[model samples]
Target: MPLRFPIRPEGLTSGPTLRPSGGPNGAPTYEMWKRRIGASLARRDEWKESVIRFFVELRGERVITWGAEEMQQYFDFWVNILYSNAKILLGHIYFQDPKLIVKKTTDRVIELAPMIEALAQYYQRELKIKRTNQKALINGIITNLGVTKTGYKAIFGEPIEAVDERDEDSIAVTERSLRQMGLLKDEKKGVLDPEKYHELIADERPFVINVSPFDMLFPVGSKEMDELQWVGQEITTFLSTVKNNPLYPKELTENLQGTHIVEMPEGRRMLGIDRDAFAGDEEYKIIRIYEIYDMKNNQFHIIEPTVRDFLHSSANPYEVLDGHPYDFFQPCISPGKDVYGTPLPKIDEAVRLEYVTIRQRIMAHIDKFVARLAVRSDGLDEATLRQAKQGDLGSIIITTDDPNKVFSGMPNPGIDPATFIHLNQLLNDLRISTGISEAKRSGEGRRKTKGEAVLIEKGSDVALSVDQDKVDDFVTGQARRLVQVILRFVDYPIALMFADPGQAEQERAVIPSEDIRAEVHFSVKVGSSQQPNPELDRILKTDLFSLAINPATREALGFQGKAPDYVRMFEDVVAAHNLPNPEDYLVDLPPPEQELEEGEEGGQEPANILQALAGGQQ
Candidate 1:
């Protein structure tokens, strides 16, 4: 019998059940969604496959190869337009360096910077392991834009406490062998030191991991911000080997006679449940688990037959990871909207056409070059004629008395001038379609003037700005969700160590309590946002410093205003330059001799101006 998951009793009409008795495959909800997903993917399979093929080509993974049987073969050449375009896009609009901000304003809140730093460290460490850092994020964004037309960066907490027995055993054997050889000191009970032993084991840090778009399946006709009414994945699992493992649900074990099951040594393997649920040494049978998430009517249902198998004897599995809006598997789309975004390759058909045309021209050029050397066949023997077909001999064998009558004149074909022009035009078309100009790709040519360079850069930025904005929004949302996950899940104290803006080593203790987490909000600041243009930064810093002492632009810049927060501005500039903390050098300045402006109540000038004057006098 076909795999069937009954969702309704014969008497029931409709309540919260997914499907009634005559529903799809007798599994009204799951089977229906499965068919929808399969159908939708079938429609997009060609496009998706094309995008993947193009990306692999650009990466040099898929090369065009021809055997000796081929009459003529063209050398595979990819201007790698997609690669260059993605690099530019990432260089400009990738993930911002995240900084956690406490929304509550209190003296005690300032103490939260260390905790915020720790949270940032946690994200960086986790993202790095999962290859979702700034650079990787850019790659994902560009790939999705160029291929899939949508990108995803999922944030889910996973246990980092699992210890690999193989690693542990290897370490133990090494230590024993070293002890026997007397290579290590025997001062303690064991040759291996406690610190060294600890170093070999994985830490107990809970971290988040990313799920690739290829690995994820969503409902058909889904939008980014829309409520994911139904989402699911098929996980693989094993059945228990015990005579009758009470934990194994009868529905799963009995109905696992489906053709899609895999047999294993210890037990049979099936799809839908977690493979890691049992150890290799453990006797178990494999089973599939349909991890379905139904969020209709504000109720999230994690329906699975094996739920009872993995649940604690006294507690339910749902109690552990109950559904929450924050925990919903979210999708982040780039250049996306109410409808799916158009892929870069699809949007630029000219590039594909031009690329194909250029490849043909190159093959023609190669054919012409090969045909340049002609073999005169007038007096050539049978063997000689065969050899001529294989290669160029430079000279022909001739035995005829009248060579001129027997042999015809060899014709030399002139090169096609129009081919070069057409090739160049095609290349230009590729550049226009991708918006990756030669200047950005750094192609060899005449060096551009500063004004020309600026113009080219401006044009590239204009083409990319819309996409960048979309990416920015996506990145910001991901960062915020990650922050929320950290806040909700991570409740331990951490001694986070990081370098301050001044490149000095600094350590801070962070104990994130529910109260602190609740009061905090996250905002992603582009790593280079503060210094959009380095030249502008230098000019502004110099002007601000000069005006600090001259009293000319000081009032205008708010140095003398009621909001005498010049210290904060100075600190920002100092941080940008990686200078030492300003608090250590700060000193209160006596009242200025000049009269104060109306509505300005400050009696003391900032220490920056006094320090500037003192340094000048010295």
Candidate 2:
């Protein structure tokens, strides 16, 4: 039976009753949330399927359905331009080392910048953020949307077993040992070892996870994620995993049943899971867990609707940025006005279909042009015709007096070169539509001069800058969320490397929980992750060297023509070229007063700037 909603006389419609006609309830039953999730999924099933198809096309898999077998065979040749285009796009967006800039709003938190930036670097390293961003960018390019969930995770170590006080020998030894290790807080109040009692033995840190668009769900008609009433994530895991997870109740997990929904096959197939493998296996059953965050009610829930059970429910545990921990990246701007606007994919459906059509036509043309034999049966005998048809080498054909009538080669039609020209034009169109130029894709430009090539590269960069800006915004948002997690949940002090200005080596610094202030701003350095332009590097080097070598230019630029100034300029040139270990080439120059004293004592000449520059260059 189809579900129906209630329509009022005023011409307004309300969804079906969440609870049964007359069921007692403190909160909406698991069935109600399940239905809500179902409605949200129903609203976006078609859209999600389209995104999935885009991914399928990106993988170079066949997506054409209801086609003739012969035609399908001919269409087997997929030019797979999408794959190459996506690869080039990903390379341009993937950041090697993301430079996160931090600023504090209040003067009181001014000292926290170094610690916070260091912590950001720590999270980037531990979480493998560069790799994560690459994955998200790939998904974003394919589906037009990318998502990341950020939160703090605290993992505690194994607990120490309780020792009975009646066994004085055992109690005494345990208490004394714990006291020596500084784990004991009280002896008489039954709380002997605080570490064992509090279960604070393990690591706690922030985490970021790349979320698939299919796994995420928002309320119907939600234009923006922030304005949504609720959001949910569908997690599929083994039954044992849920049972062993400390967050979910073990009793509920043990009694819960695995999901057997027929509607989930598409999603499962996309994730590369075989449905039949664990269908009826009780021990290895797969559980579908829905983690829903109710922003309006400030509640979080973990439920297994297959069993109609709520495994866990509570107020929002993470009160970080926006009181939720999700950041979204859309590579292309949505064409619609709504927040849930349909994003324009880099390799859209129309482009893929057109490419396949053109390539298949070219294939068909070639197939039709293949040489075939045609002989006159009236002039040639059946055996001779068969032998001629076989066309075997060294087999002489005994033909009639009019050999031309008996055997003749069929005239083959020439394939028009225009067909290939059209195909090439189609390929160029694909690149242009995706904002990828031939030079960017091939990593070479047609320009003869370096300046012209640089100009072309710059033009390509401008075309891709929009997507790059979106990625930067996504990363900046995630960084802010991580900082919030650090401020609110990081209880212990962590040691991290702090990059001090004017210092050759990074210094180790420890940041305690109190030092992480909540009021801070975050942003990524624009284009910090982009591939370096050799022309720009050359220009910078030229300018710096000219300044170092020309005394007049330095004096004009307010640089005191001195040995130390020349050394600084040389270091700047090395840095501009991205050469490692600037310190290795530098010499420890004496202070001017010391140099003067030495000159007076030994009547030595002042340090020569030109020699110092030359030696450093060598």
- lDDT by residue (tens digit), candidate 2, 1-618: 112223234333221222232223234556778888887777667666554444445445344342444333432222232455566765556566787878667764566677778778778888998777776776666556677888865555656554431354444543443332224445465644443333433554678988876677776655555455567888888776787776565667767676553333566788887666556665566777888876545557887776646787666655335646777777766553233456455335576577778777766764675544443455677776677666542223344456565444433246577866877887777777777777777766445555776787787888777777777778888898887766665444555545455555335455654644457667787444445566566565657677667767656666544343666677777776668887888766644432345435533343677655444222
Clashes of each: 13, 0
Error of 1 at 358 (Å): 3.8
TM-score of every prediction relative to native: 0.47, 0.62
TM-score of model 1 vs. true structure: 0.47
Give the poorly placed runs of model 2, Cα more than 4 Å off: 1-29, 55-83, 160-198, 245-251, 259-283, 336-348, 370-426, 491-518, 526-618
lDDT of 1 by residue, 281-365 (tens): 3244454444444343222222334223321111111122222222222212334322234444455556666667567656666
The list of candidate 1 runs beyond 4 A from truth reads 1-85, 92-114, 126-130, 133-206, 223-227, 234-289, 298-342, 369-419, 443-448, 457-464, 490-521, 526-618
lDDT of each: 0.43, 0.61
**Candidate 1, residue 613: lDDT:** 56
- Each prediction's RMSD to truth: 18.8, 14.0
Residue 595 lDDT in candidate 1 = 64
